[model samples]
Target: MHRFFISPQNIKENTVCIDQEEARHIEKVLRLTTGDIVVCFDGTGREYQVRLEGRENGILTGEIIHTGLRESEPALKLYLAQGIAKGEKMDTIIQKSVEIGVTAIYPVSCERSVVRLAGDKTEKKVHRWQTIAREACKQCRRNLIPEVMPVMNFTSLLEKIGDKPAIMLYENEDTNSLKALLQGEQFTGAKEIFILIGPEGGFSDSEVLAASRQGIVTASLGPRILRTETAGLVAASIILYEYGDLG
Candidate 1:
């Protein structure tokens, strides 16, 4: 069945009203009509089994047949604080991270970041990234859409994520692996996790030291260096697979 994410307001007593854009896709593109079944989620862990009622003036209405809780979301919440990369790489990272069950994403501006955004330009880019994340949630059947926060600088990110079991990926950090860290006594039943990945040039030494001082555990992703975009996604997948989700 086709899946879509809609706002809670779109859902009424026993009906779901899909607005123009999605309605057009169903009516004209998919050719789905009355009695056709589809699955819809409210992006808040609520899934509804719906049957099309009819379409009028670009609005497609459906009757909710059944509703249930979403089971696909990981038990652990994984947050990605990624340094802004060049071009479409950040887009790919956000999309894939959503597919892998990330709960939220924070686009951080680091010292080595290639892309810089400020004022109106930053707002536009954040909006674009959010759209990408929404589409990814729809495609991946995620019940909860991962939030893409407004861009933040490195220090601000650290301040916001204080005392969380945060992991900062560093190529030079050889003492600990994420897997090993998870197994240690310090980590147990940790529900909220923050994973930070640097940009194309990676984090500066001073930045790494600052993050370390804030208690963010710097870990390595094996000997081979992964690209800035690849590191976070790879680490997220491994972490989800090991501790909470990704079955």
Candidate 2:
């Protein structure tokens, strides 16, 4: 069965109305006709198996055959505070992180960040990242779509985190490895975890120091310096494996 995304409002008592690009794909591209069985997921953790019905005004409506909750979501609510990198780096981080079960992503602007955005450009970038996150959920068979939050400065992100259990991945930090951080008592039975990863230039000394003082443990992936995109994904994967639902 083909899978499509339908908003919750489009779904009535027993019908799902699909429109826009999805409808075009189903009609012209795939040539799925009436009676075709397809799957639809609303970003709100529910999925429905729909039997195709007649179309109306270029919109595809289907009869709901079965409905259930998607259990693919990880129990841990992992949030990524990623320093905005240049161009596609931010997009890749958002897409891959969502696929790996990140609960939400915050694009932070650090002192060392290469690319900066404001006003209309910032809104546009965030919208694109959020779309990428939704597509990633579809590709990875995840029921929930993680949000790409508005871009904020380094200090603002810390204020949002507000004493929550979080970690900052610093390349200069040689003392505490990420492996040992999760094994420690601080993360035991932790339901929510936040990770901070720097941009292309990495974090400044002052940024790392402030985060550490605010109770965000500073940790490293290894000796080699990974790109900004790689660091967040690596740390997220490890955290999920240790404390979340990943193997």
Top model number, TM-score: 2
Off by over 4 Å in 1: none
Query: By summed lDDT, which 10 consecutive residues of candidate 1 come out lowest?
Result: 181-190
Clashing pairs in 1: none
Error of 1 at 82 (Å): 0.4
- The residue-by-residue lDDT of candidate 2 on 78-151, one tens digit each, is 99999999978888999999988999999998998889799999999999998899888888888788989999
* Candidate 2 structure lDDT: 0.90
Worst 10 residues of 2 by lDDT: 52-61
How well is each residue in 125-172 modelled by candidate 1, as lDDT tens digits? 999999899889889988888899999999999999989889999999
For candidate 1, the lDDT comes to 0.90
The C-alpha TM-scores of every prediction are 0.95, 0.97
Per-residue lDDT of 168 in model 2: 92
Model 2, position 153: C-alpha lDDT score = 96
